[model samples]
Target: MEPMLPEESRFETGLVEVVGGYAELPSGWTVDTPDARDRFDVSRLTRLLRDHERHGRGWPGSGVDDVLVEVSDTGERMRANVVVRDGDEEIRAWGSVHDRAGGRMLFVHIVDRDLPDDVAKVCSDVLFHWAEGQAVAVGSARGLEVQQIDTGAFEDDARQHDWLEGAGFDRVRSWWQMKRPVTPDEATLVPSTDKWESEGVRVRLVGRGADGMPDHDDLRDVHDVLEQAFRDHFNSREETFDEFVHRLREDPGHRWDHWWLAELLDVPDAPQPVGALVATEVSSATGPNGSYVSYIGVLGDARGRGVAKSLLSTVIADAAGRGRDRVTLEVDADSPTGADGLYVGMGWETSYVTESWHRDVPVTGTPRQQG
Candidate 1:
C-alpha cells in the first residue's frame, strides 16, 4: 500500500463523510476502494463497525462529521475521525473512511501491526486521541454530542484486536456473509396449497397494468401492511405512506415485478391486506444475479397464518417467471422472533452473518436515550 498524500488528510465530526481525497493514518494501515457499495456491501461494513465498537475496539467518532480518506502502504487515502464524551464511563468512539465512485466503494483497512507493548500503546493512544478530538470538534460545530464511533473490520486480524484493546476497545460480535446458487429446480418449487387453507385467509398474485404500475389501492394497502408489520422491529422508525413510497422509488434497483402482497380473508366484507414483500432485480457488472428481497412484512394479526411463507413462495414464483436465477434477502440474526429459522425453513441458507454493536446515549431534549 502506498502512503497517503498530505492533501487528503482533512477531518470533520457529525455527519457521515461522503467524500475525501486520500491520506494515510499511521503506519501499517491501509484504506482503499471496495468493489461496490450495494446493499450487501454496506451491510457488511455496518456489521464490522458495530462489532468492533461493542468489544471496545471502537470509540465514537463525530457521528456524520468524520472525514473519509483513502489509505495505503506506499501512500494511503481514507476517511478518519475521533470522538469524545465529557462524563461517560466507557470510552466510546468509531472512525471509518470510505470512497464510493461509479457504484464501487473503497474502505480504509486498519490492523495493529505487531509492535512491542509500549509502542502499540502509544499508537493506540494516538489513534484514540485523534478520534476523541474529532468528536469534540464535531460536537462544537454541530451542537450535538459525540456519543458513538463506527468503523469496519478486516477478517481475523490478531494485531488489530490487540491494538483495539490497547486503545480501550473490545470485541463485540461476528457477522457472516452467505450466498446460495439459484437452481432451476429450486426456482420451480413454489409452495403449493390447493388444499391448504387458513381459517380466514386467501392469497393471490397482484398484477400490474401494462404501464408498469400497480393499482393505487393495492399499493396503499401494501404500504399499510408493511408499516404495521415492522412497528416493533429493530432499528425501525415508523414510516409514513409518502416516506415508504419515496424510499422504494429512490432505490437504484427498484422494479415492479418483485413486489408482492397478501390479503386476509378473515374480514368478510372487505378483505384487508395482511402481508407484503418487495424485491428487486439487482443488476451488477460484477456478476449476474437475480432478485433480492428489499422488504417483507406480515401484520401482527396475521402471524402464524403461514402468511410469511406464502409471501415468500410468491416471490420465488415471480423470480422464476422472470427467469431470475436466485432470490436473496437479509434478516436480523438476533431477532427474538427467530425469523432466521423461517427463512432457513424456506430453503434460504446463511451465507454470512452481520453483527451490530450499539451504545445508547441520551439526547438533550428527549427523555429517552438514542442508539
Candidate 2:
C-alpha cells in the first residue's frame, strides 16, 4: 500500500485529508489520532463525548464527504491519518472550533503523543501549514478579516511549544484550576440566609418539584442576571437566549440542586436579580470527592455588594450539606473583575496553572515568519 494525497495515491493519512473537494474517514474510526486515543483516559473521553452527545455540540462536520486512507506495506496496517474539508472551516483543522456566526475559529484541543518519529515530524509540519491555509481560505470566503486558533492544554512540553512557536503561534494567557474543601460550615459562610437580612437582598435556592426539574421562571431569572453581570467581562460574547439555555442544559455536570439565585430586596419591581451561581455535582467514580462548581458569575451592579461572597458561601454550604468533600473551579488569572480575590477570600487555592495560546488570524493574516 502507498501513501496518497487528495490528487495522488489511493489513500492518504495524517490529521486531515481532502479528496475531490470532499473529506472522508474510515468506518468505525474517528478523526481522533491513535495516540490521542491512548493518551486520553477512555473513561474521561466516554464522559466528555457522552456529554457532547447529550448536548448536541459534538456532531462531526458535514463537509467531510471525501474519504482517504493510508495502508502499510502489509496492506493491513495503518500508520497515520488526516480528515479534510470537514465543511466547518474552523473545525476542519482542530482545537475548540466555535462558530461566531460571522466567521469561525479552530481550537486544536490535543495531539497524539505516541506518533511515530517520522509521522510526528510530518504532522508538526502539516499542522502549521494547514493552519495558515485554513486562515487564507476563511479570509477569502466571508471576507473574514480575522481568524483565531487556540492551542489547548499545552503543559511543560517544550517539543509541543517549539512546534507551535515554529508554526507562528504565541502564548497569551494562563488559567488556573483551583479546588477547595466543602465543609458543612462553609455553607454557613455563604450568607444566603443572613447576608440578605443585613444587606436587604433577597436570596433563594430554587428547588426541584415533583417533576424533578427546576422552575423555568427561576432558571430564566438566573440566566438574565448572569448574562447582564458578565456582559463587560473578557470574551464577553453576547449569547442569545437559546444559546444560554443550550449551554446550561448541555453541561454534563448540570444538576437542578446545584443552582442558586439572588435578588435585591430594594428593587422589588425593577427586575433586579443581582447575583447567581451555577454549580454541579461530579460524583467521584475514582473515589468519594464531593461536588464542584463548574462555573460561577455575579452581575456587575451586584459586585462589591457581597453578592459574590454570599453566592459562594451558599454553594459551599449546599455542597457540604449534601456530603460533598470538595468544590473546584477555574479562574482566569487576569480577570478584570477581581474574581480571584473573592475566591481566595473564600479559601479557594490554586492547584495548577494552564496557559491559553491564541493566534489572532484576522488581525495578523499571514503566520508570523519564524525567527
Candidate 3:
C-alpha cells in the first residue's frame, strides 16, 4: 500500500516489459510501444470495458470514471497496447501488469470486454507471456522458477471467466463489491457516540494534512489498528508504517478531514486510540461525487461492543454530510468475521461479483536462498 520510489516503480514495469517481450505473442499486440498515448485511447479502452460489463455481466455503467495510462515515447516504462479489430469496431485494451512487491506472483489487470472471442483469446495469450517474463525476473530475485499470472473477472461473465480458465487460470476465490446510497434521512442510523463518550472514547476527525502532508502519528495509528483488525482476516499482511503513510498520501483524491481516529479509554487515567476509518473522495466530472471507505478497523479488544458499527455509522453520516451520493467497499466472500453480513445489514447491496483467477509462476530453477 505504499508508493515505491521512482526507480522501484520503473523496476516493476521494466521487468514486465523486458522479460515478457521474449515470448511470441499473438498478432496485433505491442509491448512497451508508442501507443497508449492520450485520453482518447483510455476512453476507448474504458468504453469497451463498460460495454462488456454491462452486456456480459449485467452491470451497467463504468466502475472506472477514467483510465490514465503511461503516455510517453521515451520507452522508459512498460506500456502495452493491443488493438483488436472486429469489422469496424476497434476493441482497444492496455494492460499495466505488476508483480506483487516482496512477492513472486505477477498481477495482470485488463479492463476490456465484448471483443471477438478470437481477439479476446489473443489478449489472454499476450498477458500470460508478459506475466511469465515478470515471473522469471522475480524468480531471479530469489532463485525461483516460474511466476504466477494472477487476474480477475466478474463471476457472471461466463465468457471471460471461461476464457481465463482455458488460458490455464483457475478461480481461486471470489468477492462482493458492495455499494450503498447515502440518503439524508439515514442520519438516524448514526448511533449516538454517547456510549463511547461515557466509556471515555474520543471520536474525532484526524488532524490536518498540513496542505496534504498529514501527521504521521495519526496515520501510523490507523495502520496499527487496521493491521490488528485484519490480522485474523483472510490473507492479511502487515504493511510497514512508512508504506501506510505514502500509500494513502499518494492518492490525489486523499483528504485529511476524511480520516477519522477513535480513541478508547479502557482506564479512567489512560485513553487508548484503538480504531480508525480512512476515506477518500471519489469524483465524477459528469456524475454525482461519492465517498469510498478505503479502510476501517478497530482493535480486537474493541470488537462486538458497537465499535465497528459506530465507525460505519460515522463514515456513512460523514459521506452524507460531504454531499456524497453513495459509499462503496469490498468484502472478502470467505471472511471469517461476518463482514459481508454486517455490510448487508447496513444496507450495502451487491453491485457485482468478481472472481480471482490465480496461476502460480512456475519457477523452473532452484529457490534462491536469502543471504
Q: Pick the candidate with the highest TM-score.
A: 3
TM-score per model over all chains: 0.53, 0.65, 0.78
- Candidate 2 local lDDT, 245-351, one digit each (tens): 54454444667677777777786576467788888766564545566676577777667778777777777777776777888888888999888888898888986
**Candidate 1 — what's its lDDT?**
0.49
How many clashes in each structure? 72, 26, 10
Badly placed stretches (over 4 Å) of model 3 are 1-6, 10-29, 34-37, 59-66, 69-91, 104-106, 111-114, 142-149, 187-198, 209-212, 250-252, 284-287, 363-371
Ranking by TM-score: 3, 2, 1
Give the Cα error of residue 345 in candidate 3, in Å. Answer: 2.4
How do the residues 1-371 of candidate 3 rate in per-residue lDDT, one tens digit apiece? 33333233323345344544423334544444224455555566666656766765675554433333233332222222233333334444445453343343435345355556666666666655555555655555545444555567877777767767776788888888899999876655555422235345666676555465566677767778888888887545455565456556545467777887788767758667788888888876676788888888888787666666677788788778667789988788987777788899999998888878877766654443320
Q: Stretches of candidate 1 above 4 Å error?
A: 1-180, 185-211, 214-217, 284-287, 361-371
Local accuracy of candidate 1 as per-residue lDDT tens digits, 79-140: 44332111321122233432211111122322233335554444345444455444333223
lDDT of 2 at 87: 24
